[model samples]
Target: MTEQGGTCAIPGDHHDTAACEHISRMLARISDKWTLLVVRTLGNGPRRFNALRREVGEISQKMLASTLRDLEENGFVSRTVTPVTPPQVEYALTPLGKEFLCPVRGLAEWVVANAERIDAARASYAERRAGE
Candidate 1:
């Protein structure tokens, strides 16, 4: 492995460096608290604006709107508008977004499986800090 831009880049593969950079950027975008929650919520199916707001609980209207816009720009979600007297907007995971679920769910499962160990580690750190 070679290090580039402070990232461990795999060697001997022509695309490895570029691929690592792309994956790093994608993870930065999707791993945010709100983004992950939004992605997971949309995994259920397409949802209207207000419905998404309600389901993603505690997200401000402003933040939700911004998140959806970003996701749409990234090709992870699609925004559809229904032509009616009152235009209706719905958001759904695109195929790319759907493929992202595997890793996201893996993260969720990891958190669940390690909760106790994490808590214990935190407690040990606290005890050490207290002694220090």
Candidate 2:
């Protein structure tokens, strides 16, 4: 990567600074912990707000709401409301969201597969640091 003006440009890509910034912002949003968990949960199928909240586990209602709003605004998730009685609200992943899941699942699998190795590495690093 090379710095052009104030933005970093990829070695071969032609995106401008503004486009790069937008991509960075989007990657940050989708890579957030809450967003990842929510997307993974929704990948199972559409879910009611309460069901989704329950399945995601440990995420506060407020945080889930904010995450959902952000995902919907960015076109990764869709929200549907049925106007009956108290009304039913559901959230589901868009096609883009589903496509995004491929890499997310791959990362999750890699981490799971290497968790023991990672733990050993962390322990080794800590031992070296303590000796210093």
Candidate 3:
């Protein structure tokens, strides 16, 4: 990498600043609750539309469809449609999506592992607030 005007450019590349910003925005997008849940559900295996909705729970049809579209656009999920008397659609993780599952699962496991500590902290904060 080379530094130019306080911005580091990767070898043979341009727009490092823009790339960083874009990646940050993408991270925020996928780190959202709906996205994470959708990705996690898909991690288990391919799922049809209605099945995905039921598994994710409480996500409106519109929201789930939107989330799946976003994930598909991002190349994190693959959508396949089979034709017959009626069309059948299934959603599964792409290679990229499967790669993302590792970190998401790790983060989820960490949250579960720390839930008690987090609750304790929240309770302590609430007590302090009550005193105030």
Candidate 4:
């Protein structure tokens, strides 16, 4: 690793230091628990705020709003408003966000496949630590 523009970047990689930083920041955002859940929930289809909240579960209103705002600002999600009685608002994934789901789903599948091995490894590690 090399320090470039105060961010740690891999040397000799195709990506420039700025590109590495951008990727790191985006990874942090999408890898967030709420962000992942929200994105997965939105993957099904567009949803109203309350419906999204209900589906996401255990997320506070403020956190969900903040996550949606960040996703929107980052162009991963789109917000639409209809001029109805109460002006219905909906949130859905953009093309980029839809593309992102590929890796996310892959990661989820990897976790499911490795869960038993992971649990056994963790148990062994805990046993060794306790003996220490």
Best by lDDT: 3
Residue 71 of model 1 has an lDDT of 91
lDDT of 4 at 56: 98
Compared with the true structure, what per-residue lDDT tens digits does model 3 show for residues 64-84? 999999999999999999996
Could you tell me how far off, in angstroms, the CA of residue 13 lies in candidate 2 after the best superposition? 4.6
- Candidate 1 weakest ten by summed lDDT: 6-15
Cα lDDT tens digits for candidate 4, 1-132: 455554445555644767887878878888998998898889899999999999999999999999999999999899999999999999999999899878878887899999999999999999999999
Query: Stretches of candidate 3 above 4 Å error?
Result: 1-16
How much is the lDDT of residue 114 in candidate 3? Answer: 100
Model 4 gets an lDDT of 0.89
Clashing pairs in 4: none
Winner of 3 and 4 under lDDT: 3
Off by over 4 Å in 1: 9-17
Q: What is the lDDT of residue 34 in candidate 1?
A: 89
Using lDDT as the yardstick, the better of models 2 and 3 is 3
List where candidate 4 sits over 4 angstroms from the true fold: 1-11
Residue 11, model 1, lDDT? 50
Q: What is the RMSD, in Å, between candidate 1 and the native fold over all Cα?
A: 2.6
Clash pairs for candidate 3: none
Q: How displaced is residue 75 in candidate 3, in Å?
A: 0.3
Give, for candidate 2, the lowest lDDT window spanning 10 residues.
1-10
Stretches > 4 Å off in candidate 2: 1-15
Shift in Å, residue 35, candidate 2: 0.4
Tell me the lDDT of model 4 at 119: 100
